[model samples]
Target: MFQIFTSFFIIYGSKGGCPMTITKKLVPVIIACCLLFSLFLPSVQAQAAAKFSDVDPQRYGWAMDAISFMTDRGILNGYPDNTFKPGNSLTKAEFTAMLYRLFDKYRPNMQEEDADLRLAGYADVPETHWAHKEITAIYDYYFGGIAFAFKEGVEEPFFQPEKKLTRLELAQIMYMAIPFADDAPGASCQVIMGMTDIPYELFSSYEEADEYRFDGRYSEDTGISVDYYVSEGAPVLYPLVLVKESDGSCSSSFDDYSSIIESAVASMHTSGIMTADDSGYFRPHAPVSRAEAVTILNRTYNYLKANRNLQQYSSLETSSAAAGTPVTNPQPEPPAGKPSSTVNPAGNVKTFTRDLAVEGELETMIDTEGYRSITVSIEAKEKVDVIVQLGGKKSFIRHEELPQTIALNGIKQVSLETQKRVFDLLNRDADYTAVLTVELK
Candidate 1:
């Protein structure tokens, strides 16, 4: 037992000479390794059961792909109940446990003198977490003298280890330690702020948002908080990538932007939409057709909305002047182009009862260019038109009703997929803007 868990650490922990000499004093290590190896023998050849379908494909990016690969190699696994909660941030314990599964051992003698950073002892976890021993051991032996984000003596604290990680934060962590896969030439990590006009200072200096820009341009770098341009009557939030048409032609069309895929991947990485591969490449620039984009966006939106840390919309409920349920406060304005829908400040995520669609109609409007969110409630189950317009073009106007909710074993589940590749084709000229409408009655 002792040898079984200690071998990996001993090998990876040592530096000056042959750590793999199979020391005579630890002969029990050989026997224990054999016993455990035999006991869990069949698992060695086992394949992972996860796939891209196991993840939210669109928003997750290469992280999902890498996880699927490691999982299949038997170096990783799903939960006890057969679900891989991929979006959940890994606790230090959970991550260390995964490392153990990968190598199957520990290094108790490893000195943890120079920690990259130490977690301030949380009141609830004063070295009692199952991972305390392993984490301390690894820190002592392997990761000495490294500088991680936290302070050593535990003053203010890294308060939320359990908090979901953002895609960028995870990338930063991996980039700091692991080797990143290089981006293609001219496929640099570029962060665009004030999409209309990027800031001069941010171009060279640093900011939180600049990290994103640098991430796109440089493979690894620090962060900077990039703001929009103070001049040119730009919106309050500065430098975002304002993608224009080929001729600097300004069109609200979502179609002209295949370049956004890189942005999406970067966004996914920082926001925890995806996990990181020890290899740092996030292939965001690959070509993705609009159909793929829609599917990806839909899945990404679902994951983002489901996770609490990423939820940023302040108000969502909008009571139409006609028959919609009363929204407490006025709906917050929609993103550019879409007419503003009022929402409550309290920001209740309304579970649109199927009943709302039975009598009222979903309205659609657009006057600017950017992202927007709208939800239609169904008072009852019935065929209804969900009118969608992106960048001012009506893409899909169809009548469909939600499938009746069904219980599988003990949980409620829903699945949706588009039919016959609607809204996207191989042709380049098909891009168009749209406004969404969930028509009622």
Candidate 2:
């Protein structure tokens, strides 16, 4: 039996006069009634079920729900000592086993043999190994085509069955394995952009007039597009994980990578399939332990199960265009305008003459108004395509030589009050560097 005592006080103030205070105390019977009403309210501690001994209710509180959810579903379990070790590193074999179990747990019937027979033929993977099935399945899914390219003169193929899995490896693997929509990489029908000047006919999709438009590169025999790319003349492809944060603005912390992998990480991070560590780092180069891998896989499993009944695609309506038909290109025409400001490259810039793919982005604030023309001196290793967006207006230019100008009209003036004035140099496909200059009038 508990009691709560509260006193009410009212202050009466008069102009040019002293203030008076009136106080009233509630009856003991009324206090008792209030206490009785509070008895019906749920206790936060009572609602929580004791799941593990080591996972503290205070420190690891964020993961408590995920831990409980996984444990209840039988996807995760503690050690013989009844402690869930969240800090341990994950191994390759353990991860593979977890993945196999996850897919088996969800789509028990869809599991079948992949067409590639040699995938399971890794020398280290014995028929009796626990992860053989999963290793084989994933290997079959990305045969000689994934994140790590295939070498022409390699003596043998290896899955490194017992090796430790790195964070980047985990990201790549989880991304490739998950069954997501076509917008993501490695989907049954993948849409890839950023390649410039290639014939539009190269991109073909199964469904007509699809917004994705282009189908991923496919095999001549299978007629199915696979997720793979060539790096230094080697075919490579890999897997997925991601995290969807509360805020709509999403990004991954693994910044040191090429555009392709960066795009994958960004997609996964935004979709809530993967998350960063406590220090707010992705730890891309760090290895994941067996326990961590199992926990993450379990989380993924629970996500799938919860959303199992929901329709994957909301709209069944589709376009009626042919598969290989070229839709409108993403490039926009230059706007008409006069010069307003002058922008000249000041720092030393290098020109790349090697046969390699390199890319970057430059963001700057523009305070100029009216119509403008941009002039630059540049050379291309193969080709240079520059896309510029000034304020809300955009323009695209393909130049192989310096001392060239493109005019854009219908530009608006920048207001100091408004914070929306922005300019960007989208150097998406520039192999060699160039001396750039922009004039707005």
Query: Each candidate: RMSD to true structure?
Result: 26.5, 19.0
lDDT, candidate 2, at 52: 55
Q: Count residue pairs with overlapping backbones in model 2.
A: 45
lDDT of 1 by residue, 201-295 (tens): 22221223324443232112211111100112222221232223222222111111112223333334443334234455433222222222222
Model 2 over residues 102-189: C-alpha lDDT tens digits?
4553221133232222243555567798776666655442323332222235534456666666766676666545532112112211
TM-score of 1: 0.27
Top candidate when judged by TM-score against the true structure: 2
Model 1 C-alpha lDDT versus the unseen true structure: 0.30
Model 2 worst lDDT run, 10 consecutive residues: 415-424
